[model samples]
Target: MNHASLDDFLKHGTATLAKGPVALIFVEDAVELDSTLRHHLQCGFKAVVALMPPAFELADDLEDTVHRVAFDCSHPQAVFDAVNRVIEAAPGVWLYYGYNAEYLFFPFCETRSIGEMLAFHTEERRDAMLTYVIDLYADDLENCPSAVSLERAHLDRAGYYALARPDPGNHNHPKERQLDFFGGLRWRFEEHIPAPSRRIDRIALFRAKPGLRLRSDHTFSDEEYNTYACPWHHNLTAAICSFRTAKALKANPGSTFDIDTFRWRKSVPFEWHSRQLLDLGLMEPGQWF
Candidate 1:
């Protein structure tokens, strides 16, 4: 069902937000929007909320399946704003957010439903799951100028690393169980990407509660929600295989002319399986077996 605007959705369509495990997909552009939605829907989310511009068209079936909200994705803090509002309205619900061309993959996701993984996480007392935004791009940009192609998607097999996240209020000490992850196309082509936007780590899957806020940095207002794991054990992590970075880099005029292809020696074909991400150490299974 399509709502006239975000406010209209909040007022009339919020009944869809009554359940848990809702996916809030922010459509920045029309690129792979249908595939992105279908992926999350297949993950067994209770609801999939598509916050997109009214101009963008959705597949007939998707229009019937997802709760569509007209939103201006280009506005500053658009993602954070929309997500936080949903959080406020759906306290105690599981929430996940991503952009177009981004696919979420958790350990054993091929056979296990996302609900099963979140159930395990909830039992472990984890309110959020860390997800690395693994950059995906077409092997050749000449034919696929947008740098996107699900059939020919490739990602960096290496170059991913993490640094201790510092606590500014505590004499710059590293935050416990928290690290600022970086890599993928953002790190490879840093000249064109802004420093603040380089980190690929995001607490994408989370449980909403009163006063919970998604920060501009993709972290959360609640400190614990930003942690990568519990103090006792390593927690489950997920990966968002995305073409957003590659699309942006190739779309931007400054970087567009400078690159002919996104492939490098380290680039490998994305197998589109959770095991591949696990083998590459992009995500962890934690205690779930």
Candidate 2:
């Protein structure tokens, strides 16, 4: 069901949230909406909610499987409000949120469903999972003018780095277990990206509680939920292979002229498998086999 606002959807569209993990895909543009839905459905999310512009059209095939919500993605707070409301309505349920053209990958995701991975995560007493937003761009911009192509996607094999996340309210003591991740398109084309959005670290997967809030920075109101791992060992991690940034950079008329192409020497074709991200250290397998 389509809701005019996030409040309307939270009040009405979350009846099935408790059944299993839910993926809230916010669509900034029309590119790859069908593939995004198909990927999440395959990942075992009980409900896949698509929040897009009023003019956006979902594929005919997704009419029955995916839920549609009318939203203005330009307002970042809209996403946070929707997630917080859903979590409040169904505490302890797993939820994931991302933009269109972003695909999730976990270790052994080939043979295992996301449900199985979350089950393992729950056993370790973890509420949130760290996800790296690894940027993916088309190999030939001319052939794939939109800067997106599932078949010819490429990602950076190296150059990813991180620094301590600062706590501005606390005189830079630094937030525990949180860091600012940077790499890929954003790093290569830093001039075009806003400073606040450069970090690729996202607590994309989490078990929601009633009072929890997803902050504008993509971190949760509860500090522990922002951690990279548990106390004893590293918990499982996921990779969101995405073309969101590349798509934005190329679409912006101001930046388009400067960016001849997204490809660089470090770039390599994405293998479209969990093993590729694992070998690149983008995501962790943890204790799961």
- Candidate 1 local lDDT, 124-165, one digit each (tens): 999999999999999988789999999999999999999998
Clashing pairs for model 2 are none
Off by over 4 Å in 1: none
TM-score for each model: 0.98, 0.95
Show the colliding residue pairs in model 1: none
Q: Please give the distance, in angstroms, between residue 63's alpha carbon in candidate 1 and its true position after superposition.
A: 1.5
Q: Local distance difference test, per candidate? A: 0.92, 0.88
Q: List the lowest-lDDT window of 10 residues for candidate 1.
A: 11-20
Q: How many residue pairs clash in each candidate at the backbone level?
A: 0, 0
Instruction: Give per-model CA RMSD.
Output: 0.9, 1.5
